[model samples]
Target chain A: MIEVKDLSFAYRTGEADAVPALRDLNLKIEPGQLVAIIGHNGSGKSTLAKLLCAVLYPTEGEIRIDGVPVREENQWEVRRRVAVVFQDPDDQLVMNRVEDDVAFGPENLGLPREEIAERVRSSLEALGLVEIGGRLIEDLSPGQKQRVAIAGALAMRPRFLVLDEPTSLLPVPVARRLISTVGDLNRREGMGVLHVTHSMSEAALFERVVVMDEGCLVLDGTPAEVFRHVERLREIGLDVPLAASLAHRLRSRGTPLEGDILDGADLRNALAAVRESTAS
Target chain B: MLELQRNVIFGQFVDTGSPIHKMDARIKLIATFVFIVASFLIDSFLGFALVLPLLALIQLISRVPAGYVLRGSRFFLGFLVFILFFQVLFYPGEVPESSYLWRWGFLSISTTGLYTAGILGLRVIFLYYVTTMLMLTTSLVDLTNGLELIFGPLQRIRVPVNELVLVFVIAIKFVPIFIGEVERLARAQTARGVPFDEGGAFKRARRLGRLLVPIFISGFARADLLTTAMNTRSYRGGRYRTKLRQLHSTATDWLMLLLVVAWMLAAWQLPDRLLS
Candidate 1:
């Protein structure tokens, strides 16, 4: 399990003045958990993602990965478990070609030739990138490049994959497909995922959602429980899923809708049930 | 905007599955060294006459188009002409008064100047051809592996061979990426009415200078990301890194190395006096 206790972080802009990015926050992610953290700009979701990956350490508190405190001396332990895919694919990819880039992580671990090759092959196949294994990264589409970046990260076989808006630059359909793939990887392989995104629809797809506002963890539960606080979310410059917002609007207009609605299917069924109950 | 990726093919690989492309990168590297040495040793035009046919033969064997190969060098060759013209105009080398083809206050062209400039130009072209062919045939992976292994002995003496070779390889690999960035910036400038293509060489050069600022800024940003990405992947300067692909030289590579060595020796013994 990854544990964060009273974690606070700030970026030092000057010698005396420091900008607080993450206030004292506490969260726990169990093994094999799939969670999404949603927040607006400057809400500290990205900062939390970076801190979890050991790229940035907390200033006031501690993060423990599998019981070991994440410190500079034991950073590799944190990194060995949590791998992050950054926002831009161009920034992360070092190799010219797809397969080479996938193999890069395994090669860095100083794995033997056979193991590295196997990792590269499996990573490429997992990301459905085997066809373009030999193609140049520069020639790939933005979607393909993002997929390649994810594949490179997956090659490391980290227990928790932290995706920091990996699909923010992609088209909607492409982003949906990429998120669906990550969801499948989570369910089928029992891999942990901390998908930090601003898209509420994408967050709604995950099992659990964590809401961050002003560097504090304001809400944490199943998607249904989190999306129920649409007012709080809106006040923090965040939006709930479209279906949830529609359902909330209907309820406020004196239309009774039952149960916490998160996605379109839930809203549709709830509205149908309300109609059926009225007719009966 | 230019076809920054497609048009720049001189240093890009063209995999033909030919024997030359399949040869060990070490042999190609050694052959390139030999060709550079031969370019310096052979002072006679007749020597280049022999060397040119050999390069052509290798080009044919490599199966890349002759037109494309020549097109790759067109811009460099144009610039080379201007350079050689200045070299001949200055005629800084000591020349007999009777040997002067044309003479002015500080501007002169002599037989010796002509000969010196001609030889230097040919040598440079030779170097360019050999290096370009090496790049066109060998992939960056092979180049890095070859360089690391070639300099592996220096590691015992505390030289960071693997890191140095990786730095060199990454620089060459990013050349096209940066070129594409420049092309995009130029297009942006043109869209904003910069008159990029309407200028002479001097104006074109000054305009090109404007693109460098953003390129460097973007380059640094990219570098920062790449560094973090590399660190996140556990890259520790390649100290304990084991390669996924190992280099294995073949008989054909050995034979190619032998042939190049022999040719370099023969070219060195060419008679410059007879050509004069």
Candidate 2:
């Protein structure tokens, strides 16, 4: 489990009047849980992820991962335990080849050659990239390259995986694939996934959702509970999920359709339930 | 001849199971030196005929098509022809030693100048092919590694081997990126009504200046980002850097190296005409 107590961070631009990105954010995430943090463009979601990964140190307060505080001395160790996949593949990918790039993390960890090789194979296999392990990262499609990035993170064998708007720049199909894969990792392996996204549908994939606004945690609950605050999401310039929007419309029409619908499949099942009730 | 030169330069170094490609790059580097030296020693038609066949044999074993090699060689054909023409015109014709091959008014062409021109042409052509073979078969990483190994002793005097290799790698990496950027800039300029083609030399120079500003800015930005990324990954200087795939000299490598060395030594000892 990870705990953050009054964590606040500001960008040091060598100025006296620097504005804080994350303002007194208090959050606690349980182990083996997928937590979705959704926010508007400048809502400090990315800054929060960076702070969590120890990429940027906090200006004030404390962040404890497995009872160890993330400070300057323990920064590298913290990062080893927490791997972050950035939004841009180009920014994260350093090597020319896919296997080499994936192996980079383990290599830096100074693992034995056999262990590094095994990790590379397992990570690539986990991402369904066992065949194209030798291919150039540049030659792969965007979806494949993003998977390669995920494989690179997976190779690190980090307990906590933090992804900052990873699906924001991807196409719908690619985004869905990424979400499913991340979800699978969280569910099957108990890999703690902290997915930072503005997509309401992506938030629905996670068990718990944390909605952030103006550098503050505004709403935090299960998808159904959090999404029920529809006007609040809209007021913060965030779009509600299609099913939730439709469910709200139907609810206004006095139909007994469930307002807990987040995905299309959920809506379909809800409609089936309505039909079954009417038939009975 | 010009066309052949271009083909030779351009063709050859793609990945193939060629003997040259399979050989250690260090040996190939040494062989190329010896080959270049042997070509310069070749002075006469007989010498050229002998050396040309050897070059052909080397190419055959390289497994790269002779036609492709010659296609690459064509790029430098213009320069080769110019050199040959200059030599033929400038070399003085001694009378009575050899009969005039051709005579036009005050100008007389003798066998001596013709022979010299032929030898020079052959030497140029052979050297070009040998260099192309070295480049085509060897990967950039291998070439740099070999260079570093050869220049390793220079590091004792603080010659900055790693820095030099870094420069070479960075140059190779940025060339394509810069070319793409230039293409984009040229299109942008054309769209803005700047006629790059119609400009005079000075006007063209001005247009190039305009193009360079954007390219430099973008290149600098990219370089900053790449530096940050590389540093974050802990890629310091190349000192004590262990490569995952290392270059090792095999039996074939040694054999080829020995053959080239023997040929160079024999050519050095032969008579001037034979050597040529």
Candidate 3:
């Protein structure tokens, strides 16, 4: 499990006063849980992702990865436990070739060649990128490049995978495919996922959804529970998923939709139920 | 109109999986240096006949097409020929009477001048071939590992060899990226009515310079992102860092090294005896 206890982070800008990015955030992620973080730009979602991966240290409180505190001394351990995939696929991939880029993480950890090769193979296979393993990273499509980035992280064999806005640059279908692949990894491998995204639709797919606003964790619940707070979410400059918005509209029109509808399937079932009621 | 991608193939590596391609990169690097230095040592055309065959043998082992290598060097071949022409026409230091074939006001052609130009041209070709072959055979990761290993001892003297190696790696990796960026920038400018190809040399250069602003800004942005990526991957420089693929020289590598040493010795000594 990953635990964040009263974690606060402030960026030391040029001036004497530091800009606070996160304030006393408390959270816990159980193993194999798929969690999505949603917020507006500069809503501290990226900051929280960074802190979880120890890219940025918490100014106050502590972050413990698999029970090891995220300090300078335990940095490697923390990194080994939690690997992060950043937004831009081009930026994250350091190697020219796909296999080499995937192997980069394990190589940095100083694993043996055989082991690194094994990890590279397995990670590529896991991401369905075995065919492009030998190809140049520049030649691959943006979706494939992002998968390569994730494979790079997976090769490290981290317990928790933290992806910060991974699909922001990807096309809608490509982004959806990428998320499903990630979801498959979480389901099959039992890997804990902390996905930070701006897409309400994407957020609604997760098992749990967390919302950040003005450097504070304002809402935390299941996707259905969180999407129900449509007005509150809108107040924070965030949108509800399409289904949830439709449900909210229907409720406002006195259709009496009983529950939160965060996905297309849910909306379909709910609409069918309404039709059956009216027909009866 | 300039096919930048086609022209910039200096560091393009071909994965032929040949013996030379599989040879430890450090050994290849050392051998390249030895061969280049040996190229300068050969004084006679007879020596070059011996050396050129050896170079051809290395190229053969690398399995990269000789035509491809030659095509890659086509951009610089014009410059090389121009320099050779000037060297042959203008005998700078001294002109022996017996060696002079033709004479004009300040330009003269001599046997010595011809020989000097030929040797200089051969030197340029050999140097280019050696470096190009090295790149053609070795992947960038292997190249970086080889560089770090070769310069590994310098770390004791606080030379920051790892950082230097990273700089080299990043610089090399960015060549194709920047080339593509320039292409895109040029295309955008072309859409905006910039005549990139219809201009004279000066106009073309100035128009090309206009593309640099966006490329540079994007380059800086990329550098920023790359820095974060590198740091996130736990790149703390060369200190206490270990490699996944520990470079181990094979029997072929050793044999190649030995052959290079022997060739260097022969090239150094045989040229004088043959020339005299």
- Of the candidates shown, which would achieve the greatest DockQ relative to the real structure? 1
Better of 2 and 3 by TM-score: 3
Q: How many clashing pairs does model 2 include?
A: 24
lDDT of 3 by residue, A158-237 (tens): 89999999999999999999999999999988999999998988998899999999899999999888987889999999
Which residue ranges in model 3 land beyond 4 Å of their true spot? A5-8, A14-20, A59-62, A66-74, A112-118, A234-239, B43-50, B66-68, B77-91, B94-118, B153-163, B211-217, B246-250, B258-272
Candidate 1: which stretches are off by over 4 Å? B1-7, B271-276
Give lDDT: candidate 2, residue B191: 85
Model 2, position B234: C-alpha lDDT score: 33
The worst-scoring run of ten residues by lDDT in candidate 1 chain A lies at A10-19
What docking tier does model 1 reach? medium
Arrange candidates by TM-score, highest first: which order?
1, 3, 2
Q: What is the TM-score of each candidate against the true structure?
A: 0.93, 0.73, 0.85
lDDT of 2 at B101: 72
| Clash number by candidate, in order | 0, 24, 0
* Tens-place lDDT digits, model 1, residues B82-141: 899999999658866899878899999899899999999999999988998998888777
Error of 2 at B198 (Å): 5.5
In model 1, the number of clashes is 0
Question: Can you write out model 3's per-residue Cα lDDT over B83-150, one digit (the tens) per residue?
Answer: 78899888634865777788898898888888888888888888888887888788888998999889
Write the residue-wise lDDT of candidate 1 on A1-280 in tens digits: 8999999999984548898999989999997899999999899999999898888887989999889887888777888888889999888887777888888888888899999899899888888999999887877999999999999888899989999999789999999999998888888767899999999989988889999988999999998888778888899988887999898889899999999898889888998999999999
The residue pairs in collision within model 3 are: none
Candidate lDDT values, in order: 0.85, 0.76, 0.85
| Worst 10 contiguous positions by lDDT, candidate 1 chain B | B1-10
Best candidate according to TM-score: 1
